[model samples]
Target: MIRVHIARQFDVRAADGRRLNAEELHAEGERLMQSLLDLEQCNDDFCDSVTATDADKGTVLVELLISDETETGAFEKSRTIVRTAIHAIGGATPWEASADLGADYRPRDVQLEYV
Candidate 1:
């Protein structure tokens, strides 16, 4: 089995020093995560989970758990799902509002087989 952990982050502030409600933001994050799962076939052998936490410095961390039967297409599927979910959420690319969901980390070359 392959278990992938993705962290999507959102900044709670605007340029004017305004802040977003944490509860509401977290809910939206959760919804986006669910949307990603729903993008896949229901019968697919994947176990998904989500978590939202505070960075203690005014940012929110959205963590995703993707447990799949194998490593094939895992990275691509994740990108596709997340990209679609972002469009559904705000009519814009998710990258516009959040940091790299995975940052500089990627699956080990041996464990991930795209083909």
Candidate 2:
């Protein structure tokens, strides 16, 4: 099995007198996750899972996990899928995401695990 991880963080401000809640964070995360899931035309089951964690610095961390067979082509396909997904959410230019980039997340630092 091969495991791929992708994470992104964003800082959101309260609109009106209400504060951002877990539900709202989840909705955004889900939307982003779907956009990512659509990549590679892999199966919907390949989505694995997505998580939105609240950060200490008032940031929202979105994590995506996708699993597939162990193969070089699969890895490259996953990389293409991940890169396109992140750029779409952040921006086409790398610098556009400098501010909202996840603290522990690096789009170029993808990890491949074989088991």
Candidate that scores best on TM-score? 1
The C-alpha stretches of model 1 lying farther than 4 A from their native spots are: 1-3, 10-19, 40-45, 55-72, 94-115
lDDT per residue as tens, model 1, 36-111: 5665455353345353535344454434445566554555555555556655654234245334232111112122
Q: What is the C-alpha lDDT of each candidate?
A: 0.47, 0.49
lDDT of 2 by residue, 12-104 (tens): 433332345666555545655766656536554245535354633444454555566655655655555545665665423243435444321
**Looking at candidate 2, what is the lDDT of residue 4?**
60
Candidate 1 clashing pairs, residues 3+ apart or interchain: none
How many steric clashes does model 2 contain? 0
Please give the RMSD to the true structure for each candidate, in Å: 7.5, 6.8
